[model samples]
Target: MPPSRQPGFENTRSNEYWFCFSSPNVESHLIISISENHYLALAKGPLVEDHVLIVPVEHMPSTLSLSSEFEVELCQFQNSLQRYCKSQGKEVIFLEWVFIRATHANLQAIPIPSSKAVIVEKAFNLASQKMGFKFVSKNFDSISDGRKFLKTQADEESSLSYAEISGGIILLHHVEEKVRFLAQFGCEVGI
Candidate 1:
């Protein structure tokens, strides 16, 4: 069999999807590139202030959809974004909303007050507790980084995790659909 096309890209070429940063037609200002595998770029939008999108060259649907190696590559770019923003005295919140599984994936990286980073973590953890599951938190200190962590622990049974990396720590938690109530289904839910 021919190599299977990723879930979202089975019927379309990269140019057909506006969010495919890897496409030559995407006029988004190039920022930093990691390899043919991924790149970080400034997407065209009002959230242009310190807002970056970590995009994979392949058309994966979500972070959870990525294989161990892709996940590691994605996190490496995220780690780079985190450290650079920190050095500039700015903070970033990296997140992905993937309700629609047929489009390319772009992890949004936005800056916020350094102090509010803790508040964001508390809000997610508290939300998880409300849903009756403690946030499955992990720190990469024991390992080299997220790739190592996921390679050792992640599996198919893993639920979708919303990550908030702050203060050099990465916290993963489930997005409770019950709490996701009262909003239009998709991106309107707001991060």
Candidate 2:
């Protein structure tokens, strides 16, 4: 028999699959597009109403081995989505680029109030490091015509994040822990 179909991709004739990220209790607001190969899905998470997940079409064992193009495209799309959210007056918390051991690679864009950028960044950095991931900072605003470039990347990826999806719950919890840890350090987090 051919490979067993994933729940959402039951119809072989379809190129896109629309379904909830994980739990229906989360409101099922997020949407995802599964790749033709069924190896990846571009998911929009709903952690803060404006989250996005850039997932790989294939289930990679580790994120450290992803293609350079895939990584770049993921980040670029994330930046564009954040810009769009900002234009809509939505708050952006932080972006979560996650690599699950058993599934595809995913990049989640979480929206938080602008006032919480610094706090969220610091918390994410600390939490990511604690999780054995290296932290690198990229100046997204410094890129030339950044939004356009990112939009192009998004099209290439063919994915979007939405409200009520919790695809990146693990990373979200990590961020929450970091925020709590920062609060314990006497930092007032206003998100």
Candidate 3:
């Protein structure tokens, strides 16, 4: 049997009271609604003060389970957010952690200074090397390539779109199911 819902709450994702938009908790943190079914909220536990979380109205287990239509919507939002972040002189890193029991699909957008932005990829690559997997760089000669790579790679079970930003996209897959602890899944890697 599925878990029981709290009294008087309907459509709460994973029974998380905060997932209900009507709840004051959700209302207070909302930054913008991307579409009828998607919204961006100020992350409650942000890596940076302005870190934003792009979330779907309905609960999604993970990006692995998102529909093609939703995927397109996410892409459009990312592009729009990237441009806005760039104009503000801030570089944003979009990260998604696809795990087994994710209550909602929350894509994180974190901004840092321009100088740090230039070395963000290097940090990610170094972290991957420390973790023992050679980070694969997707062919990002064009924006379309990044889209294609994300669509193809993440479609596979338990895979990752590792990192996607204005710079490019790095894709990875988790082949070992038992290895579930993603040390820094939702946080920025250190310098």
Candidate with top TM-score is: 3
Give the number of the best model, judged by lDDT: 3
Q: What is candidate 1's TM-score against the reference?
A: 0.62
| Model 1: CA > 4 A from native | 1-9, 13-16, 21-25, 30-34, 46-48, 64-73, 98-100, 126-135, 142-144, 147-159, 167-169, 173-191
Where does candidate 3 stray beyond 4 Å?
A: 1-13, 17-28, 141-144, 155-161, 173-175
Worst lDDT run of 10 residues, candidate 3, spans 1-10
CA-lDDT, candidates in order: 0.58, 0.37, 0.63
Global local distance difference test of model 3: 0.63
* lDDT by residue for model 2 (4-114), tens: 224443233222324223322322333343433222223433445544555444543223234556555544555566677668765443332221212333444456655
Model 2 alpha-carbon miss at residue 183, Å: 20
lDDT string for model 3 (23-64, tens) is: 455654456565866778888767776788777767665554
State the displacement of the C-alpha of residue 127, model 3, in Å, after optimal TM-score superposition: 1.4
Rank candidates, TM-score, best first: 3, 1, 2
Q: Per-residue CA lDDT of candidate 1, range 103-167, in tens?
A: 56677787766666667666666665665655567765522365355434433333245454564
Candidate 3 local Cα displacement, residue 79, angstroms? 1.6
Better of 1 and 3 by TM-score: 3
Error (Å) of candidate 1 at residue 14 is 5.1
Candidate 1 clashes: the total is: 0
- After the best TM-score superposition of candidate 1, give how far the Cα of residue 8 lies from its true spot, in angstroms: 9.1
The predictions' CA RMSDs to the true structure, in order, are: 5.4, 11.4, 4.3
RMSD of 3: 4.3
